[model samples]
Target: MEVLVNNKLYAVQQGITIAALLQFIQLSAHKGIAVAVNNQVVPKTAWDQQQVEPADNITIIRATQGG
Candidate 1:
């Protein structure tokens, strides 16, 4: 299945969870990270439970330390 990640298309396994996708992208579930699916923000605690559907729009935002 293919899903949009930060506006880029990525091929991922079927029924992959947001947490899994983050890991696959080498991103940790650390502080200052936000994820939204289809324009809706998903809570950090729900990352593992929310499955990524095909063609779903996923947005990942991370905070930086630089001013």
Candidate 2:
């Protein structure tokens, strides 16, 4: 299946959870990361349980430590 990540299309396995996707993307340390699915923000506590649907719009943002 294909899902939109940060406005770009990326192929992913079916039934992939947000937590899995983050790991696949190599975000080993996601302390400052935030995710949204289909325009709705998903709390960090739900990443492991939130499954990505086909064509779902997923956005991931991470905080940087620069002023």
Number of the top TM-score candidate: 1
Query: For every model shown, what is its TM-score relative to the native structure?
Result: 0.92, 0.91
Task: Give me the runs in candidate 1 sitting further than 4 Å from their true place.
Answer: none
lDDT score for candidate 2 against the true structure: 0.91
lDDT of 1 by residue, 14-57 (tens): 99999999999888755899999999999999998989999999
Candidate 2 C-alpha lDDT tens digits along 25-66: 787577999999988999999999989999999989999898
The count of backbone overlaps in candidate 1 is: 0
Query: lDDT for each of the candidates?
Result: 0.92, 0.91
Give candidate 2's TM-score: 0.91
C-alpha RMSD in Å of predicted model 1 compared with the true structure:
1.0
The 10-residue segment of model 1 with minimum total lDDT is: 22-31
